[model samples]
Target: MKNIVILFALIGLLVSCSDEFLEKEPFGELTDGQVELPENIESLVISAYSILNGQGNEASNAFNSPASNWSFGDVLSDDAYKGGGGTGDQNQIHRMEIYNIDGQIIDVVQKWSVLYEGVYRANTVLKALKNTTDFDEATKTQRVAEMRFLRGHFYFELKKLYNRISYTDEDGNYLSNTQITPEEIWTKIEEDFNAAIAVLPETQADPGRPTKYAAWAYLSKTYLYQGKWQLASDAADEVISKGGYSLTPNFSEIFIPENDNGEEVVFAIQYSINDGSPSNYNGSIGDRLMPPGGPRYPAYGFLRPSQNLVNAYKTDVDGMPILGNVDLTETDNVDPRLDVTIGRPGIPYKDLGINYEESWARDLATYGPYGPKKRVISANHPDYLPSWPYVTAANYSIIRYADVLLWKAEAEIELGNLEEGRTYINMVRERAKTGCYIQNLEGTANAANYMIDTYNDPFDSKEEATIALRTERRLEMAHEGHRFFDLVRWGIAADVINTYLEKEKIARGFLTGATFVAGKHEYMPIPQSQIDAGGKDESGNPLTTQNPGY
Candidate 1:
């Protein structure tokens, strides 16, 4: 595959021109004659990788189609709030947060467009590879595998967001609206990943490229989401036993610039800074996530962590979560991850050496007291480019080894391997216990009485293990944007989110009447723009149907 630098340069040219003249075709687009050359084919494959950051054109920020999914996966769930200037400042996201979304929302339309746009790019590469005969058979097979992996990832995102979607391939032919079921989509996704696995190497020469192990990890997750316990467990086992991946010693280290593609990262979106491009394509979403106006950090303050999520970190005397207990006391022990994930009162904020004050919040009355810490980089850090200070160079991990272990535990428990499940869960918990605690600037004391202990005994039943797994995942993956989807896959989005809204409404008055309607709110409505645009079939019927609610 071609490097990201070349890909980025080529993407700018590709999206601009679409004329039919074969002699003047853009560098990014491949004509029938161009596909026969190995170099041109490689560039096409690299173009597919370039859109991983969701940047199609340079004019607007790709907020709706960000690789992070912070809006859809985190804010829409209990993990965060749509915190900006106010509810009016990205009301569509707020509507999503409050379960008041519709088909006409621009965020919905952009997200749908960008993802399908990704599918189109991947299909382009696949088509080119299929037609090329100048390359060696070995190279051809490998390139095909890589393209499939990219396509699988794009489809997986669509599958998780909108349960019922149209399916398409390299020919640009899509199934009639809602013709495919979620299970069928899952099967296709699985097939793509499996094909990638057959030819991908265990490790890639380039850091951003996916490997066989990355495919395995994703395949395992795909199966886990579908409740295919045995398949999920086996796939996870293959990764754990042979993938050679390990957790980063410090949880806080995972997000820093120096650890861009660390050992803990299974796969991550590669980002570069000072790449001579004024476009924020290489910059991270963290630029917008900084506290609205702080002494050092300045940002829009979106995706604020919820008080319920903050409270969920509270632990009992035994270093376990204070489950079923709402009355949090000063003496309540809590997981260290709370400090690592969120910025609250009196804690050192993102290596600034100054405590995060409640006054730093844009509007405490509307959003909350907490701000997201996981994505913010210290202004003092060397990677903090003055050119675009808001857009840091932090690479966001799509899958980490810790995520794999947790999924493994979930699958094991579901498959009746209770003790084995406990072992995997504890491995993650044990890793969390060490080198993860933040400390005072003086380095003389723990940040917030941090304490986290592993489960010493076997879970009494699968339900017990399930609760532990769910809570562990929330605390482990908090602001990284996996909470909502996890809740949906567990079939408990309604209960978990409604209960969350009830508590949150009392704290953040903006969520006064918020409620998660079970069946309908589980998936977002299909974009109206897509429906209006070529969403109809041969009989003039709508090819793209709206989701049940809107």
Candidate 2:
């Protein structure tokens, strides 16, 4: 057993020094007094977890190094636009949104530094644990597993964003040219998660910590991204059959502060407020993207949902999307998730009882007339500690049960089990059927004509099932930061995004010449700062080769 009492003694010290890991020299010899004790070793582990929120970095702005993937994953895809004052606001992101990104953008460099900084912190924990002799074997093993799980997650994000990345660990030298292939990177990520699964318990006392099943779900996701159908299917099945996770009864409750870390949450980033700290480390990036000048708190309107995404909610009488149809009228039958996912005009913006209006938007002409609803907290919430009225105590869900189910469905369909895939898809759609609609303050009527239905018949063919899976994922997880990555993984980003831009140009004038170039735009370029820092090999050759066409 571990010494819990000793562990708590160093928790505050660890959190206070988390950001220092990025600047601390890993190769510097540590004195025996630094991390030789059990309590100090445990503090290093806690420090690793503290950086998971991706905050407190002085190298970049909060919007650039946000924990949320809204900039690249949503705005860069067909799901959203880089909405702010105009095309020039946060112009680096706007450039990325329109496929004009370079290797020198601050956002790219900041994100790269933040993720690598996380890897460094995790490595520090592992290294300290290896050297510590006073810790119990069981506690040491569990902490090792936890650190590796965090390391794997950070590398996984780096891999998806930049396919070619340098590998590092506690024992490994910093900025070394490892020359690992993409396949090899995926293998390393899988190994970490597998090791985590082997040692982690089924349940954790703290909900923020990863459990054995969280490792399984993430392993499944890694496989799905790499097109390993059978492996993905098996891993997902392990979570489904053994992981005791289920869909939250209501979709709206999934994002609310009170229901955070609930039954549906497989893993989430824990955030706290009013802890006598000036830093907004616990505040989520979503808080910064709220619509501006509302009766409620003021917000910076970034990552506005695209019209194509808004139109995607339009469903037929049977709860099926009007595929290939982009024009949707307000009176048209639409999926109930629309209201839950977005704040449209004339709808109540939450329990505030004030209706959302076009005036809520910063500039309707530049972006669109929509505001994200998932991350906004009610002013009346008990945990409402609004620093500058843009920070909140909302925990961000990184992996949820619904995401696992969808991945399983994707794997099943890819493996030729069309009917099985349809069953999983409908499971999500069914849960979304109830409590998905937003109603008026009196609760007498729905704000909009909300409608949704599950697939009653088996998929006719694999092609049709694939399309249904794609559309379902778009509607179910829209604006949650999965759109661009999904498209890239499916090898259809070029087709889907180009088509979206072509159609959207007519409605949103800012995207008149925006284009998504294939091969080059699939992954972001390695930041020029990283290249300048350590781009060369021992032979003076470019070790960190930039992405093609950068």
Candidate 3:
């Protein structure tokens, strides 16, 4: 626990908020005499947790979060859907077909800056743990494990976003300003996760702390990105086979406020109104996504589900979601997951007892579609007093067993073990009632009720199976910030993204719209301020060029 103290001191030194908070310098002035070695270590670790979750609000709620903005690039470039924004207008995303793209570039830059700020805090905590002399040996080891887990987690974000980034030393110094290859960064990431796995406990006595299973799950993802097919598969399998984690019987139970800290969640950032102050970051993003005055009954929702994403769900033909090869206009029959994932008009709202009539109406006259219910609590509601800062009941899952299952499938496929890969893929599809639903149409029960083996989808080739596995990922993990990177790793960013844009033009009647060209504006440009301030270039630029084209 002394290590916790060291961790706290390090966080106090490194993890300050924006410029305004830093100027006040609440943490820096503390003397050694005032530092409580063991008693305050918990507070320091808590501080780190606060920093990590700080962006969840802006990212998940505001819809302005970097990864989500970048994800727009994905849908725009694909055949899925399109919005109404014309070139340089509010519908700028819609203008992608016309080759007008400058706003996206700006979003990329902002995400990069915010993400780096997160990395800095993690790095600081890590460095502090390394130098602290106050902690005992065992406590120090556990603290180090936690720090490494955090560092690797942040690096994973960097990897997903930029594909390549520089590694910072213990003192927050860049060991190499030059861009390391993705493979190289993966090496460091793999190393950190492995270390974290070794040191983190299997289950934490505290709610928000890291555990052994969490480390394993995170490493599994890193391996997936590295194309270490076997490693990724094995790590995911490890979580299931040995990590003592399980799928919660009911999906809604996983999200319920009371069920938080339930057995199924391996790791989630615990948000409590009582534990210190509530983070505005933890406020309800789901409510904010709703159209204004859409449904105060449910809460502040603003983000409308794209028609394309909604269409991914298919009707249960024989108890499975048969993939429909229809135009975007057809929505009479769709997959159950669509209802579970995103709300749509005309879908019966159990809570509201009303059906949304217009598919595209998302205004005051037509309340937002009621499918994917926003899980966050609203502050403006009558129950929430002004003194009681409004907060959502959100336990953001950094890792989940479903992802591990998908990772395992990908690994087996890449290893030339198609049969093993099929097992994992079918396991997921079986649960979703996808493909040949003949086995479980009732849709009333959990995994046990579904009989998935009746329909066997064997891959004709490794590539075929790989595509299927990735497709499952898209459906399974959409709106969770994994789609953009999935495109990058497949080397399909240019092809997939551009196709989406063309599809939107044809479907939305926005032909001559914007196009998402790769290489030219794939990743975000390095922040201009960082460049002017002499920040180390994570992109390995010669400091002359502005990332190919500004």
Candidate 4:
């Protein structure tokens, strides 16, 4: 494993060589022995983050492009729903039937390939570091831990979306004829995370490095997927108890750049426009999804919020949106997070002036009651953008303290510690209200709304409580991109999503051609190319079993 670190350092050394050698770049063709210098290895290791970029880039704004279509399928198809216009290419997502192959091969299949490629690279680093003699023992151990953490994280994505995913070895090759069951893959992921927990330092020594707590946070999620409630609870608790993380008083500040690196974030994807290219799609998620043809110029508000979700926000104590108990309008102060979570068309952006003209050709709208407002970013002004007040690059939170606390609450409830569970839930709620950025939970009534009766008991029955918890998870994590994964893990995608579709259609008054397929559609259709490469299952059939329906 240390050999991998040494290998990277070697690559960096070579990269620093004379202009001719650097420009000509003979290393790709060179033998390992020929290019075994310290600098080359370092360059290669540093390049691994680019592989992650393949999962999300600047053009798509991390919203789920062609690569993240499964995320959209798992979410928009049934658990949640949205309808918008794009060219056939763009509209495919709206219709929930997106699949296309491009000339460069950079689509969903490529993303899957690249994720596994990342795994192979990390494994190579781990194996090299294990055998390297030149690196210090401490450095070797830490490096191995980093690779393991990365490897586990990659596999976690595949397992969640695709169910059974193929594993690879150190040399960027998949194990032939190997098909790991979902449970077996979880076991492997746990093993990798556990190894990371044992060896990673408690704090990061550099940007993007994994820490002991990062390992624990990821393992907590892994355990939850595997149905190990106690273990998941304990792992999250471990991070909360001593990891030096805490909830930020203001939930919005966590997203704003001026307040980044706060207590709430455990691990976040680092972004810098001046340092390099901003994420290709991540920088544009909001604008890409904005409503089309409105006063808000150049915005294509894509992620439209459902009226159902908008109504979910109970009114202020006095029952007004921005004020008390008045007839709520589209723009209400019911839950400030609703604006922060999902943007509605009629809602004023506060910053938009009469001079602004929105770009609807790209599906952006600034006026009228039609556009989505969540996670919209401005290349010029970030004070209004969720990611930050000044930064162009939106930091995607991979793990955060708030999630751990919520998980603690859920696990405790499932374990039958109702009081303890409520305590954890309240901790999150209290922070929301008292934290400088957010208003009173019920708005200026008790100052601590959770202490009051209205917002206190989220559900009537234990089953209802579970549903409430899941809903909270969905709302809290929306657009940070966790909703789809949560639905799939619980195997509730079909029912939840199809219900949403019917509601969407009913709301929009569309009667005919409304479709909801259950069972296999809950899981994504396997990429056609993968089936082509692997052939069929037992019956010598095409792998396009279609999950139950087309």
lDDT of 4: 0.53
Cα lDDT tens digits, model 4, 126-197, are: 555544556667766776777788889888876765565666655444432235456778888999999999
**Candidate 4 TM-score versus the reference:** 0.77
Cα distance off (Å), candidate 4, residue 429 = 1.7
- The TM-score, computed over Cα atoms with residue i paired to residue i, of candidate 2 is 0.94
Query: How many collisions per candidate?
Result: 4, 0, 41, 71
Is candidate 1 or 2 superior in lDDT? 2
Name the lDDT of candidate 2: 0.80
Q: What's the lDDT for residue 534 in model 4?
A: 56
Give the distance in Å from residue 371's predicted Cα in candidate 3 to where it truly belongs. 6.9
Worst 10 residues of 4 by lDDT: 1-10
Candidate 2 lDDT by residue in tens digits, 37-59: 88767667766776676654533
lDDT of 2 at 25: 56
Residue-by-residue lDDT tens digits, candidate 3, 106-162: 444445554555555555456556666676779878877887887787777766655
Best by lDDT: 2
Candidate ordering by TM-score (highest first): 1, 2, 3, 4
The list of candidate 2 runs beyond 4 A from truth reads: 1-24, 27-32, 56-60, 173-178, 285-287
